[model samples]
Target: MQSVADGSQSSEVPNVLGDFALHLSAQRGLSAHTVRAYTSDLEQLFLFAQGQGVESYAEMELSTLRGWLAEMASRQLSRSTVARRGAAARTFFEWAARTGRIEQDPAARLASPRQHKVLPTVLAVNSAATLMDAARDLAVEGGPADLRVWACVELIYATGARVGEIVDLDVRDVDLDQRSVRVLGKGDRERIVPFGVPAAAALRAWLERGRPALATWSTADALFVGQRGQRWGQRQVRDAVHRLSAIAGVDDVAPHDLRHSAATHLLQGGSDLRTVQEVLGHATLATTQRYTHVSAERLRSSYQLAHPRA
Candidate 1:
């Protein structure tokens, strides 16, 4: 561990952080990305504590945790970011206390600023159709690369999966006959997500024409591949989505917007909350409830537009 005060390395802090990271991975089953985030948050907290002349985890106190949060706020970090850091601190202290690294959990009563729930941007139905149409035109005009882009967009709209999950897909993960794909979600949880006919057609075309052309010895079992015959990257997928959205005259839409649109569309199409939760592989129903708010807002807008009331 590096001292937060003068940038000198420490002995015990690093060892404890390593143990905590192992606990998160082996026991909690958090994804590597999530683990990395937590690790970074704790490291920052430790650095802040050290800067305040606190040297070890045992010296960590509620006031020290609060001071770290205050510093983050003083720097004008977003409420969500502060809240996340607070959560990381809380979890780390709890684990430390449980494992006898600390006599008591200092962060037990730690409070974080309430994060404002910002509604995610979603495409209108016609706009989504236009985006798909544009992608389809590209597929028809270009060769393998075009087909792969189209398939990726279609699957994203159909399944509401994260970009990470999309790029991690292997050939065996998709099942054309079942119209479903096995998605490895956060925490390495697996779920089968169904796709529409358009997505299915696009996938089949990519598998037959696009992927075959791109596949090399290095490609292995990747369902989607880049031009150089490697697994598709998240950046590439994001770029494709942005390009397609721009071509369709819908500016500023990212891959996550498509997922938001899918969830809102599902709710507007009469899908239940629990079902949507399952489909999106959300760990908690509360995480899925945001879409309901989106649906309600849309309904209010539609009512205001169409009704004769003044």
Candidate 2:
């Protein structure tokens, strides 16, 4: 082990950052998945640099960073994945520099890989309604899948929230009297999103008639519980959305599509961009503006359909 100025030690043969990452995760409150990814990414970089006779991160140069990027591209990694790796590297190096382990940050000037600006696809109002209707019918059957499926579809479209946010919701997060649900969005930011009467009705049905039947002693306070009495995860919500979309004749619909549908419909109903931003919990207004484009496209199609003159 080579001791560094920061009172830290690095393996002379390379590849030991995984243990450091676990330490950061277990002690520093980092998410487990994030810790795993960051550790794996950093370990790869360290090994590559070591293969070139560079002992520590401080010995890295701009060319070495670029070479790593080229290696990622050669492996057919997506632009977004490469970009995330770059970010991870930058974060790790910054921490190293701060702790005196590294004298300089090699990733400071590393440009983020340009990602494709793929716009999200959304369902039309009628199509969304059809999906909700299917969910309702399924739930009325009183099966566990039906109850969870109904709530997933209804709440997602109603609040336009990310699936993670919806799954993390507690029973008390919803306010029936106020017609709002409190959501803890990304970065632990809390926002209140209002749901319409239909969504409220669906939620009421699930809470009153459905949830109790599925509730168990170990069931957490989560608003959505699985058949095993665990809280619903993002994967479960995605599967439910996929099934409901198929029933509605839209097999490709995703959880995010409901978010798009909400924003588009809100704009079409004359809501302003700022209001949409707040409702969607967007940190920037620029993100909410995309819905305006979707709304404009819908308006053009409507105009073409109803126009008397050719």
Candidate 3:
């Protein structure tokens, strides 16, 4: 409803946005998800700019950027989503300036609201054990399918690897003898994550008894294969996790929750922050620090439940 620009100043907005997207992918090597998210936010900005009568990336002043954010806030958007949009704007303008698409970065001094921090959801230690126990129970009573499910859940929680990384795994990525698994993380970064004996044993059983029945010529390298012998999909892994939860009588959780639980459990077990960061393949130590908070919260909960004094 606000009109900051009265006339069409530039029509190169779409073209510059395309170039920005290419830079994000080819030059920056950001993940597809990250690239898409950034592009989506920019697209919304372009729409807002169109309504404001601003025409080009170079013409977008700090007021234009602030106005765009203010508009989103007026719409009552979540702070995290709004914060992400602010980040996208900063990234776009910086790239535009660096690549000479724009004379200067308009978002240089733009200040966006910080995202509201929410604690990650994690399972308690006993609940995690119950889930694994249920997975094992199913594997014992059932065939290759159950064994594969057991192995998938064990490996996910054990390594704190993202489901995308887990589904992308190759048979060669695992080393049973050394108890370590090579996880290719975001930005194509690779790291070795060690698992406990429980995970190793489950992996061994799946590799020997389960994967053989599912592997085909095309899926020979795939560590976890689907029913028709293609590489396992993330959806399939999620389904397995849900099924395990129902059977285990624990609260339902997704694969990422398992990752959160694993990180928290490692911290509770006395693993240092750096070691947990390496295991999770986080780009920053700050991301890994959240698990320490989860552990502290649990410690407080335990003390409150046990202590008699007010």
Candidate 4:
């Protein structure tokens, strides 16, 4: 835990935090990333309480939690960040009270600032075609690595999956005949997403020729492998997307951009919000509605460009 105060006043905080982390993982089935984030948030809260002379989990109070959030706000953090931290505090205190680590939940009434709904940047349909064409060209000339990159981009655009979901996929998770993949999302939720023909073609090539050339003993069941022939990580796929964007003469974009583009394009093509929500693995229909705003912005831009009424 990062400390604002010099000395450790109580060992009980760390013990309780460990238990809470296990609870988040084993009982709640939260993804590893979320578990780590909540743990880090609680660590900062514990340290902040220590600095204010509150020594242990049982000693934590609503005022100390409020002060911690106030201090973060004073630092001019984004509303989303501040809100997430506040939510983390609320979760922690509620859990503590439930587990007998605290006598009462301090954050029962905690409220986070509503996160701003900023429109995501998505590639134009023509620009996406340009990117895919460039990816295909590279795949034809280059080796297994090129095919892997090509398949990754195509599948992401087709399914609008998160980068973490793409990298976590095993070969068995994909069904070539059905043109679908089963993604295990946050909280271990699973959904089947259908991809288009372009994605299917790229995947078939990767599975047959590309992956075989790259496979090693350590590769196991992983769909995508790095140069070392092990499971490719999210960071590595992100780096690949960056490089692909550069070479294709497009705006620098991450795998997330492909996801955004896919969602927006689907909406532009008249897909319903509920269908997009299921494909994107969003927990709420509201989360998928953001792409409709993107589509509206694009339409307005086109109208403004072409309309002659002044």
Candidate 5:
């Protein structure tokens, strides 16, 4: 971790940040992506502090943290990005205080802006059906790549797993007999998410027909593989979803839209919020509640179309 601060700033800042990053990855089990994000946020904060002539963590104050946030706002950063940065500051300061690196936690009083609750975009029932039909048709073309794409979309829609989790899956993680997949989600939490029979059939076809065509000794036991017979990447999965959606005449949809559609469809079909949360591997019920809003909006639209009163 190189110092983002100026020459006048304390070198200890970078050292402490390096230690914190290590702790997050080794002890707290945070994913590499999360650790990188937190470290980046803290580096920006340190650079801001250097500009303010605050050379050490011990000199940090609530007002200084607030000024940094105000600077972010001035730069027109998104609410989610500012909020995440605030959270990163809070967590870092808390750790510093607990570990006796700092005399007090300046960010203890810091507050993150409330994240706006925007409903995720989901495919309508007809559109989702069309997209899956397109993928099925592609699979019927008998190409290894087409079969893999069909299986990926089927598993995503069937289980609502994140693209990262889907790509991380190994052959041992999928249980065809149980119709479930073992997902390793954020914070390294593991959960078993169930898929429907359609997904099972697609998965079986890919395993029997598609994967063998691509697989090599170097492919190991990954459930999904790329054209080069290595583990599938999230970007490739997302691109495949986008391309398939466009072919189905539903443009601008991503892999996550399939997840959102799965959750919303489940709610519309009478699945409870808690069950959806568990299936989606959401840490909080509040995170899962967003799908309820999507379901309600769809119901209202349907009612408006069918009711006698205008």
Candidate 6:
């Protein structure tokens, strides 16, 4: 058994977990994205154990792991984050057993906290319009930043992509000739989403005038840039959305809401469930079905207003 730094066995120890992560990524057909997340989770756990003066993962008992989770709970990490961490721990221990690094899977009986099925929040059609108009109004000089702001918000609502996918987008990502933007989403999975004339126009405006103005010798291949002349970060894009939503008088509007609104509106306009799911890059049909609830609510409102019933 590995000795703890404090010379006490509290069921927490640190080991070189990177090799296991690499094995999972290469041999198990796990995506790089998942491998990164799992490794990060292990790193966090290792750091936490070290802070407590524990030496290795093999020394960690179920109760020690539970204590770490309880600490995370006290810090209010969301249920989803907690669940992911639990899954990471479980997988790591199981891998350790398979590789003969451990005698048993210490995380075998551990379970993640149940997550709440929170329905996504979406902007009303009028509110979405307000958001677009507000972003357009903020485009001062029609410069790249302004153009980027315009294009980002417009296409987010139009294409419903996660902000990272948008930030990582390259020049070739947008095919104006095809009227679609190619998005590489989580797991490096690629999909092409169609946008209307307005989104295409905004993108063209940015590419022609805005992007050139912001372009530098050191500029990467990214389509969006910050004031620092570098590619846009996820936080920067999210902050842009937050600020624009505030200006649009819809403070709760987020990048994801634009996605939700886009999917919801498509369904409202008679697009099928599977089509929206494909457009949104959802992995499960049930995940795509939540919009049905939103549509039913809208229908109920329409019936109430038009039925002429007392």
Give the residue spans of candidate 3 off by over 4 A: 1-15
* Tens digits of lDDT, candidate 1, 125-152: 8898899989999999999989999999
Instruction: Give stretches of model 4 more than 4 Å off.
Output: 1-11, 308-310
Compared to the true structure, candidate 6 yields what TM-score? 0.79
Runs in model 1 lying further than 4 Å from the true structure: 1-8, 308-310
List model 6 lDDT by residue over 1-310, tens digit each.
Answer: 3333345534433344567766876677567778879888877777676667666776767876787788899999999999999999998888888888778787898888998877788888888988888877777545567789999999899998887688888887889988998988765568999999888888888888888877666665778877877887888888888888777787577788899999999998899999999899987789889999988877788899999891
Compute the lDDT of residue 141 as modeled in candidate 6: 48
Per-candidate total of colliding backbone pairs: 0, 0, 1, 0, 0, 9
Best by TM-score: 1
Q: Please list the residue runs of candidate 5 whose C-alpha ends up more than 4 Å from where it truly belongs after superposition.
A: 1-11, 303-310
Candidate 3 lDDT at 81 equals 87
Estimate every model's Cα lDDT from 0 to 1: 0.90, 0.80, 0.88, 0.88, 0.90, 0.81
Cα lDDT of model 2 by residue, 1-310, tens digit: 2333334545542343654575567656555677778777876787677667777677888789889989989999999989878978887777777767678888889887898876679787888888888888888876766877887788888888988789888999999899999998754578999998878888888888778777777765878888777887899888878877887776468898898888898888788999989989888899898888777777788899999972
Per-candidate TM-score against the hidden true structure: 0.96, 0.83, 0.92, 0.92, 0.93, 0.79
Better of 2 and 4 by lDDT: 4
**Deviation of model 1 at 116, angstroms:** 1.4
Candidate no. 5 TM-score: 0.93
TM-score of 1: 0.96
Better of 2 and 5 by lDDT: 5
Q: Write the per-residue lDDT of candidate 4 for residues 4-58, one digit (tens) a residue.
A: 2445445566677788889999998888988889888887888787789876767
Error of 4 at 148 (Å): 0.9
The TM-score measured for candidate 2 stands at: 0.83
